[model samples]
Target chain A: MRFRGRALKAYVVASLAVLALHYIVPYTVLHRAEGFTLYAFWSILAAAWVVATVVFVSWGWLER
Target chain B: MVRTIAEFLATLVIYIAVGTAIALVSRRFGVKTSSEYFVAGYRLGGFLSSMTYAATTYSAFMMIGLVGFAYATGVGALGFELAYLLATLALLTVLAPRVWLMARERGWVSPTEMLSDLYGTNALGHLVAVLYLVALIPYISAQMIGVGSIFEGLGAGFGTGIAVAAALSLTWVVVAGVWSVASTDAYQGLWMITAALTYVLWVTLFLVPSAGLDIGRVAEAITKAGVSGLGGFWTPTTFTAFTVPWLFFAVTNPQVVQRVFMPANERSLKRLIQYFAIYAIIYTLIVTLVGLTARALTEVGVLGYISNRDLVTPTLLLAAHPALASFIYVSIVAAAISTSNSIVLSVTSSFVRDLYERRAREVRPRRSITLANSVVASLVATSAVVAFLRPGFVVEMSVLSSVILLPLAPVTIAGWVSEGVRGVARYSSLVAVVVGVSTALYSAAAYGPKKAFITTWFGVPISVWVLALSTLIVVAGLLLSRVKPHVGR
Candidate 1:
């Protein structure tokens, strides 16, 4: 089966959470940080997104 | 580091010759049908699929536009570009499988055909095909302009640059259609990434330390420049305006959406997304660092402050090894040609499959392929002329095209997610596009494209408004039409 029921909800919630952190952290947490810190934070986020995507697809959550 | 025009032409000629040979050789693997010509008969493996997708998506915008943006905006440019990467990965993971399955089952050639099939209307396809022409021609012309700028920098006339770019784009597509384009795109994509790696290494290993600075000092310089954090032009509103349209690029952009139909199977499609995610992140960081590095150099008094952000990369090139710089320059040309040719091929698909085929009853496979080639040639020529003219609004029009295409997001999402987009929902797709495009055009005319893009409605950028309004229209149509919930593709 595809991402249905609990799996569907999980995917949506996780995506929304990551997205929220992406937007909110820049202003709330890193507002006064040096340029390098901010850059590292984003780089970490990018890496995490790549890992998550590979994991999700591997789990067959993205397929029908 | 100053190179003669003859030297520049020699590098470009060798690059073009190698690229042309790759494209020409690809014809042996080509099929004869229009579907084969346009989409490689939906048989691209993971490497070619991912490479073409990367090359087509990243354009001259990366090394030139984004580098400059990063120079001016600091870490915000990284955030903005990463937002796009993140969103694209999420969207592709969800939508690509469905689109690929459906296209394979139904033999859909054009992206418009898929939408038209889902919504049960040729009208939508025709309208979208026309919209593609209007929006993408300027974008294609912009790529040519990028090439012209690089050649002009090399002391070759801008006109010579544009003519060469136009000629290459036209020839590649005509040689074996998408087979040739994809083959050459894979080659160019390698060139692009290699150039990027060389550039980043040159900056970090040599340029920074030669200026009596290390990573720590560079960070200090950027921090002191006041571009390290979110303020100034990186204001929330401005970022929102800049990012919203780009976030939906996977769906709204025809060239990329068509790529969803190219990968040979489920595995290839998945690989395309995964590989592209890796490429996108790497390229994004490289360009962002290039910009920030330039800014850091300036702050430490090693280089002059470049007010025109676009010129930052060129200025930095002056200090680099001459051979390395010229390779990067050719890579920029490769980037432009790869992107422009893909656009030409895709727009031709829409023009032929959606518009022309509707009128010409029983267009034989050979005839349709011939017609497609003609359209590709015409598009290249027209874009070349537009690039030569160097219209003032070309850049604005290119940016505005994304905003104009915002309505496609809702229309496409609705078609894929719902069981059937029927009744008023079909009309809703049409209405949404018209309303969304008209609003964007009106704002561009009233406030000018640049200002209008950033113009906020209640602290929300106009781009967000365009998306919200388009979504609202689609939702209303769904409710009124009572489309059944989607079970699965």
Candidate 2:
């Protein structure tokens, strides 16, 4: 009956962090570095979602 | 753009021949019952499920619309698209299992039917079915429009393009329902990704460098272009307005929600989410990079600045080898047809399973399948005509489909998280959805779709307004139900 779990918590935190970075970094630290720097940074962040997806599935968070 | 009519025609003919062969072969698996016809009897393997999901959800928008958006707006388009990818990944992780479990347990075929079951009313299901028709027709038509434009760009005649795309979608879905659609989607998905990878490599290796720029120089040029760089059009308000609706797309879009019901088991569902995420991120990068490369070329004066963003990819095609351009063009056509096929199948299933079956005393599987195929045909014809007409409101409606469908998010979330959400609570939630949709329509009409989406009341975008209003109504209904026992179903 309980829904809370470590993996779920980690997944939520990771997703929120990525979203925060998307909104914040572009206008803040990376604002002036909007060239390849911004592109590389965002690409890596986007790739992180795939890594998160792998972990979420492998760790059974979906089952939880 | 160089007109490669002969090459394009040849590639398109071969693509259709191969796709039709796949669809016809898929019928060997057979579709005898309503469930089998609509959802492949919940027997789609992991690979097929994932591939179909990717193909259906991405659409021509990724290559054509999204590439143009990035070319015109800058790297902000990457953020917008990636946000959608991330949200979809998160939502799939949390909700896919629950939805799949319920579908299997209850023998539900349509998303609306699941909602109707939750509220214990056929009326809500019927209402949602109607809403799907209104919201999705323009979206389907938009796919036809995209195909027509690509055909016109290639010197193939617009009307011929629309008819070809419409005929393919109709034939695919009607052949063996989901089986045929998914089978061909798997083929088309491969073509789409392969074409994308090829195009990106060519641009990065040849196109960019031949323009006297490397990745570094292109990056520098993009950054130097002030308004079209880093955060150009992606202001906080603009980003929020465009992204918030897509964040809930996993649940709000019934076409994808129905996909959640197709995986045969838990492992298939897991694979579905996992594979789709990988495909999505890779495809997302390929698209945005192409757009960025186009923008970079424009910066160096190798390519002219294109006011009409959609023409960016077509213009790029002029520089590509005719063979490569032909492949990419057919791939874009494949994207359109695959998307339209899935939408037609999903929407038809919604109409037949949710609305039609409810009124009949006993369900005849054969009759239901017949009616579903007929509806699929009718919907495709209607969408094709609309695409040909190219009404002003069609684009508005297409743009607003996500916003109009946004109200379904709160209703769906409540159904999933709560038990016995019936009677007045459910009724009030339905009313909330209606109100949200009406608000979206009025704003789009009053201020235009583009402006209406970004326009705000008290600093909140229209998307947020719709979501907040619907959520509030559902909450009030739940509270009212608690206070009065008789109001509970």
Candidate 3:
């Protein structure tokens, strides 16, 4: 009853996606690019969080 | 002494200014009900929640112990910060929603009360209360040492006494009270970003190009200075430290319990999580870079690498620009005050708000508890003094606190995981605490210090590994508890 089946799965998926990006996005900025490394890294990191939220909210169903 | 004077006065100003802002807002915006006082009336938006969480989470240590760790250890120290990435996101997805739901449903305002109120058991709740108090005292001591250290380091101009500075800080805490603490947190949170960004920019413009420092050059300086000169910083090292312990703070912390009450709904909760994580990641990365820049500048022959790692950033600022250093100095104090006040308010809430009020049950007037709250504040102060007197005692105690909190992970899991959990989860968490503490003490005695044998899978501290195993045992016990059929329903 507590699981909320699809909802919990969606939550887990979003979290993993964000953490996964956290691990790699830094590497991409540090190794893959030349200009604006810090800014790139910062924007990407913040955006991953944004994307994660989108990933999470996409799972919501209309209650009314 | 002048340094201490400047630091103390600056800290006092920031605290008063920020504290008053919180109080005014709380009253003006209508924190009329107990929920508002206790949990900001559960009306917090994502932005406020994110800032408060960061302010409460960072504390004096981020400026001191954390920066110090980076100063000494290099980027390899970042494992701690990185862990927070994993932790905070998890808290949003998992922990906060449950805590809010339970608190609202049962009106269970405190962690200790939630146990008995929701579960209908007093012994389990009381046991948790004891554990919480034990875990928090050293945390408070960590902040005390932060205040005391600033006092000792500054040394001349302000005519400040350690007791005087400490008292002034505690008074600021009493002023905004809890609401004030939150308000100040929002302000301090902004201050932290500004300080971090300013340091990054200042060092980049002044130190980096002039000294011919680049990423490779930074790495080279770190390598040449070896562990001793470079202070052992490397990029990976800095990232780890920032992430790890923060995971605990963001996800599992009882301190952030009130945060859950603030968000308007599930949608807001998700947004707050993302906001805090992104901000923390960005801010931490900047701090890590700034720390590396400090190493490079020192190695490139501009400044000296001071003995205390945390002092490196502030010390560097002091050497570079006195006027700018003053702001950083005050911000550091603000950071400390914001964090310490959060802890103080948290401990006070659990003690005076939960333990005291629950026993009385009758709608005890808020004013009646003022004296008790004062006593609790004094108790935290006394423990801090004791730690200051023998810092070694606090260091040992913090190691012990790590051991103590390990059990809570399972205890909380049980509370969330099962409706018919019964006594098994409760006893498991308590047992784990005792076992983990005993083992941690033995390990500390055996290994001495700074030699925690980290495991590969989690790289969790040895004490935490002990906790993980204990939690597993609790899980098994949980299974057993549920497996057994109830005789009467």
TM-score of each prediction: 0.97, 0.95, 0.81
lDDT for each candidate structure = 0.88, 0.85, 0.59
Return model 2's CA RMSD, one decimal. 3.0
Query: DockQ, per-model, please?
Result: 0.58, 0.45, 0.18
lDDT of 3 by residue, A1-64 (tens): 0334466666667677767666555545343332234334544554566565545533442111
Once superposed on the true structure, which residue ranges of model 3 sit more than 4 Å away at CA?
A: A1-7, A10-64, B1-15, B21-25, B29-35, B156-165, B214-216, B223-246, B387-390, B441-461, B483-489
Error of 2 at B343 (Å): 1.0
For model 1 chain A, give the 10-residue run with minimal summed lDDT. A1-10
* Full-model lDDT, candidate 2: 0.85
lDDT-wise, the better of 1 and 3 is: 1
lDDT per residue as tens, model 3, B1-489: 366456556655665565566656655555333455556656667677778787877766665666666557654444345546554666555656666566666765556566565445666567666666666676666666666666566663222333543564466455545465566677878887787778778788776777776767766675555522212233433344234334455424566755666665655665566667766776776776676667667777877767768688657665555546656665666676666666666556566555566676575455534644585568657755765574565755653454456556655655664665565655665566567556555655676423332322255456456656766766776776773322101
Using alpha carbons, what is the TM-score of model 3?
A: 0.81
Cα lDDT tens digits for candidate 2, B1-489: 344788888898899899899999999999988899988999999999999999999888888888999888888888889889988898888667777877888988888888888777777788888888888999999999999998887777899999998999999898889999999999999999999999999999999888889878887778766533455577788889999999999999888999999998878888899899999999999999999889888888889999999888888988888889999989999898888889888888878887678778999988998999889989999999999999878877888899999999988877775667765887987898899989998898899886888999999899999999998998788787773322111
Q: Give the range where candidate 3 chain B is weakest over 10 consecutive residues by summed lDDT.
A: B227-236
Ranking by TM-score: 1, 2, 3
The candidate with the higher TM-score, 2 or 3, is: 2
**Weakest ten-residue segment in model 2 chain B by summed lDDT:** B480-489
Tell me how far the alpha carbon of residue B407 in candidate 3 is from the true structure, in angstroms, after superposition. 1.6
Q: Pick by lDDT: which candidate is best? A: 1
For every model in order, what is the iRMS? Answer: 1.9, 4.8, 8.3
